[model samples]
Target: MPSNIPFRPFHRPAPDISATRKPDGSLIVRSNIPLGNYEANIGAYWRAAADRFPDRAFLVKCSPDDTWPELSYRTASEQSDRISSYLLSRGYGPDKSIMILSSNSFAHATLMMGAVQVGIPVTQLSPSYSLVGNDFTKLKYAVELTEPGMIFAEDGNTYAAAFESLDLSDKDVVTISGKDHGGIRFDDLLGPVDSVSVEAAFSAVTGESLAKILFTSGSTGMPKAVPNTHEMLCAAQKTLEHVSESLDAVNDPTRVLDWLPWHHTYGGNVNFFGIARVCGTLFMDDGKPTPGLFGRTIENLKRISPSRFSTVPAAYSYLADQMEEDEELGHAFFKNVKICQYGGAALSQEMFERMQQLAIKYIGMRIPFGTGWGATETTGTGTAVHWDSEKVGLIGVPTPGITVKILPVGEKLEIRIKGPNVHAGYYKRPDLTAQYFDEEGYYCIGDAVKWVDPDYPEKGMIFDGRVAEDFKLANGTWVSTGSLRLSLIDALDPLARDVVIAGHDRDEVGILVLLTEAMQKKYADQPGALSADGRRIVAPALIEAVQEKISRYNQGNPSPSRRVGRALILAEPLSVDKNEITDKQYINQGAVLSNRADLVALLFADDGSGGVIKLNKNNAMKGDKDVRNEQADTA
Candidate 1:
């Protein structure tokens, strides 16, 4: 094992900070920062970077429709000027909002910059929100919520139904094809570029101007539109530049192949802006992490050696699995990979270790795997682990110009942030915004963190869990769902794709697990626990696997809140349509528990109708499957 107990020796210099307790028993940490503030505006930064690296390729996309279509920094900036001109000629001003209903594309990026350049807020919807579901409930709600003056989709035909669903009498549609939905061509929209009008609008852009508005993953109720100001986006990027010296995404000319959607803050504010800020090249990979599209991601990886790259843990898990098997891909992946970042979910320790081993095997050294803790409200990456750590899930200290205050909440320390990167308010909801800030004006992000070592504040804090995701047992012990869920996934790897911790207001914790596709394939021939025709799975192996893992965990942890009394393998996968999972694959803890209240009850049922395996209270005892089997016989 690596001798560094909590953290490995960082490849880069990590920031050091000191924490002192306040009168309210809250801990406040500030970076030992020397760099002062700058003019916080992306428009100015883009203009400067274009002048610095005029010929550098800014956005790269392999086109099946045409030859190599690479947009340079100079070209993109000039086209965005045209885009600004188009927006003005049509009477779209700084106050009006224009929404994009498409994935990341060259056209999408140009138009987005165009809108934001002229002080218009751009809202991009997750394609799945509109295209995946039959009802288009979330899409309609989002459109109604933003009350956008203009809607732009790349292919009008793809979003035809969405246009019909919306009452677009007052709204104008911008599309390339000009689908019979009554709109002008996106190309035609750019032709009326009045220099006077465009320049006047550009000059009015400020740090406080609204840049974009993103919707939250609607796990609880209807999705709330998060308004991201230029200050938030600019400040977040500047924080990134301050902490990690090597990652001058604003100045460094790096290559990144990413598929993270621009609608989300991570991709938009971080990856998208990271490339745009420094005049780096971003190759938009049109592949997802699903079994079907994962090959495309690997293919993209083989083609480019990215200096920095990131995604959700699920994608990393998939890539790690492929790397272990494919030697050529593994070498190519880590050859130039100086930094590997993960966000969206708590990466399991198992994944962290597996990727480390793969890295060591291929490159003779391990790359620093970093992640940050923030939300859409923080405009993504408020406090990130800029340096290498031996482990995953270290949210690290506050980034430069950001202050992280840890307040005592019951037994846990709730994390809050006061920074320029923090969003001003939610769209059209002053009532909600008033409730969001604490007495100190720090945004209450609903997340909690624990000190890895109280003595060494600079070692950074690990993610404790989400405050909203935690619940109390019937006996009143708080269950930290985030930590426990990650523990279970680690203990039962290659079996559980995702897990939900249930049993709120109940005697003990229960686990709801979604199985990996590999398990079914591995046990296909045997008298496995799958239902007839392989449609449903009641995997006996998985039950035993989880029971063993939970029993072992309880033995080490010895806390009622930590002990899992029962577990069930759910055949049904978590749905993006229902907002159970975000596009980045982070689970909606509230949504899953609320949506599956019946299953939670089933887990505790004395009748055992839920396929739950009951473990004995004594930690060492083997799990009993008899309760479920006997109930089955009786039924």
Candidate 2:
């Protein structure tokens, strides 16, 4: 931790300013912003909003015919109350947990609200997690940590297959929705219940009561369950509302179309609750943001034309490609969009510029775009760029009531945050929880970052890279793998899917690249692409293009550390089965390195030795042999 950092308490005013009163008799402080203590609980906010907009559309699901099925706030509240009563009748109340295994849907949110209202913690798991070969491991982890009283499955087949090996007989109830099964239906959970009992249940819940337990993606290790309290949710909602107001967003009934997985915090806490605070109607798009499912997303966008949009950077890249091909569809898609928020992964400069160009070309103006930085432990959003401008990499100022302490780790600062929005530590994992925070009670974010404007001081920061992902070259020069990976993609735009950085403790940085099938086919047909050694050789021209791009990137950087000294274009792509990729399609560096140990060794082969890369003995260059030997020794 950084030494002698100024200490500031949550309700204390800074020494620089004084408190004042607004004309409406509300206390206004000049320096210290009030820590968000608005509603007593998360359900209170929803109830207040429902009371204010009882007849307004709260949520909508797009149908196959391109029409919407709307649910009113009053109706949703009433149904939520019924569900709460039903849950209480089933002997599930405060201190009990219910796990939701589903995607984004109106019913998901309703069930979550009911659980929150009755003070029952709801833990949501990704529907795609069922596809993982070790699905039982993840399911068991959730069950062990949360100890859920009931399990609600979105679809019967998926639920059955996911939990077939688990001993869920001890669970009080197993409910299924979206499809009928032999088990209890979710619709059956709602029956005639007295209003007085429902109101009493809601009133009994408090701000400090636990609301949800969200698990990590488990891309690196076993998933950690993070408990979110009602206070934390209410605080996050206020922070989002404040940031939205700062960006001049109108608190009206905005339209939103999002396909982000409900299991993730970005989809559950930020998008869902953020929209609800404004009485917005959320339209669930049943499509992933990957290339395979992007067509469905585009189809939905063309039909809905949502006023506000959110997506990952890869999704935006795909949309940009589609727009480049058809301008008409781009125009229709972004016609009503006010702000487009991108998160989940770093936004590539190339993709950002493409989005800007396409938005201006089609929408008559540069669309307001923003990026957010946070994790599930932070309740989705801790920092976000204001959407008044189209800044590419800036993760804006800290939200109200949140404090960011950048602890210097070598040259970069690892981000740490402290606020009410932070989770109540990992569930039943005190050792893990103890490792995540500093002595000052700040939750270490694990990401390294740098200030965009060090002189200005309040301009916020930009992501540097992940501390664990960065490695050293042979000369001990540190390489930012995340930044280098983005640079590689920018350099090989429209050709590469992803690149893995190699050469830790080696002479120089090397890369293993996965090219797009189109580019792979183009090179496969080119003459002289096949080598005598039986290895599929990359075209010299294509390699030269990549080299030139790297040279350009090196020219823009302050140090030669960002440059890759060598690269090998791989014929095969990383596979999930090999543990080289996550379910969300993110590269797993350690797994990739372990799985491709031989390929990495081959990149540093010596002259005619190690049975790896064969050298031309007859025409062996003098200095080249020594260089190859040195590289091999380093590898």
Candidate 3:
């Protein structure tokens, strides 16, 4: 019998203005005065840091040899000033935007600071978006939104091609990072500059002035350009500071090894600015946290023991695999980590358990892992769990100075937030701006959330799912895809990469799952083993195991809406080229459903092979040899 799970409500007292200790032992409090609006100009902070901690190491760049390059606050500020002067001299300052296309590097930070110093807004676009054969639509939307005065490419060849492809020739200046690119050399922009003049320019900037125009992933249409000001940026930093303070452990002078792309808010606003605000040394890893580049992250981890670690769930899943194989590497990777933060997607319980086990075995302490809920428009973190003091899936209390309201939406509640960190509006997108915020000025988060202990008033709430992503069965049973996906992943974590929940307007929910390559290889040679296909044929034993897991999950849920009636294992992983996934690796359900319409149709199709097998009309199947060849080609 399914359990009768009771609905619980969560309430909280008004945020205390007094400073609080975060679970990690950092002090945080809401500022009495509003952070002065400077329209996203980060240069003032840079100047302040330079003045106060001139010799303190500000940024570090990691190289393959383990030799980390360090730059002091003073030197970085001076270099940024020179770059600002160069940009201003070339007719790019205040109101004139520059588009930065690069990964996370010291050069990227310097260019970003330089733009802010001269009062010019700099918008960083994801380097992943610029990949060959991947969708460049988002990049185009960004280009159109910013109408940049200059395009700064990390390298002369790769990023320069992206700039040219966007047809940004009208821009007055084009600068490349390294020499050898047939463009203006980066060194030329570092000539002597009047420090006084740069300071004056930065002073002229205000928090309300436009700082950056960030484009949302246009999964639906053209990406909306959300404008962020200095005030907004500072508010985000303050929010993070408050959360850290509540945890009480972020102020310690520690090193952070980050590989999240600078283009995303988690990287740009939270990880990067949050680190700077706390005056910590940030080591930029050139490699991403993806399977292809995660080796670099491990290599970096071996060299530096970061106090705080932030990564997406996918990366953690991969790391969990490595940890199982090499205890020594796992210990080194998590040696100094006090807080391990996960976001961007839901974390599976399997992955979560593995993390806890690794922390216990290696670090000897239960390093609290946290997750948060926010978006690019929110500047990074609006609601986050206190690492040292929360259960999994609880997106903790609202940050200081932020107001959250759960607005009723039929049977569910939509999460909404109102705060200084909330974006002023979308750039030249008044329609979207009006639609995104309610009359009360709360930004509609589009996520559904519920209180696990509503009457308790202090225990915070748990994330439900995306309201927009939920759909109803023909019998009127609404299935929360986000919730179902989370539950499924939680049940099969460390083995599955992601799963797509289907059966909307059907009798019951179904699933299309993609297992990690490691797991696929593990069962490759087993009897009745599945071959890689959109419809992989798995062994009855493994199928039963998965079914039992699903059954176990359903046993604790309230209704059949949370249950999976059947599942189809996909042999192939969804790729970015297909638009079935986002840069952050979140599966786009609508896109995936549309792309796999045929497979889905087959799931409901009448066939002679026990409601599972349908004749391959397209001749997609061959033999193991051909499938292996295709896999090799993909790799």
> Global lDDT of each model?
0.77, 0.68, 0.68
| Model 1 residue 459 lDDT score | 84
**After best superposition, candidate 3 residue 606: deviation in angstroms?**
3.5
Error of 2 at 448 (Å): 1.0
Q: Estimate, for each residue in 499-577, the C-alpha lDDT of model 2 and write its tens digit.
A: 7888789876777766654466677556654333424344555555555555555456535367665556665556655
Give the 10-residue window scoring lowest on summed lDDT in candidate 2.
6-15
Per-residue lDDT tens digits for candidate 1, residues 214-316, read 9887677777889888878888888777765454555545788888889998888888887766667888886777656777778878877777778877777
Q: Pick the candidate with the highest lDDT.
A: 1
Mind giving the per-residue lDDT tens digits that candidate 3 earns over 265-297? 877878777766666788887666565678788
Ranking by TM-score: 1, 3, 2
What local lDDT score does residue 588 receive in model 2, on the 0 to 100 scale? Answer: 78
Q: What is the C-alpha RMSD of each candidate to the true structure, in Å?
A: 3.2, 8.4, 7.5
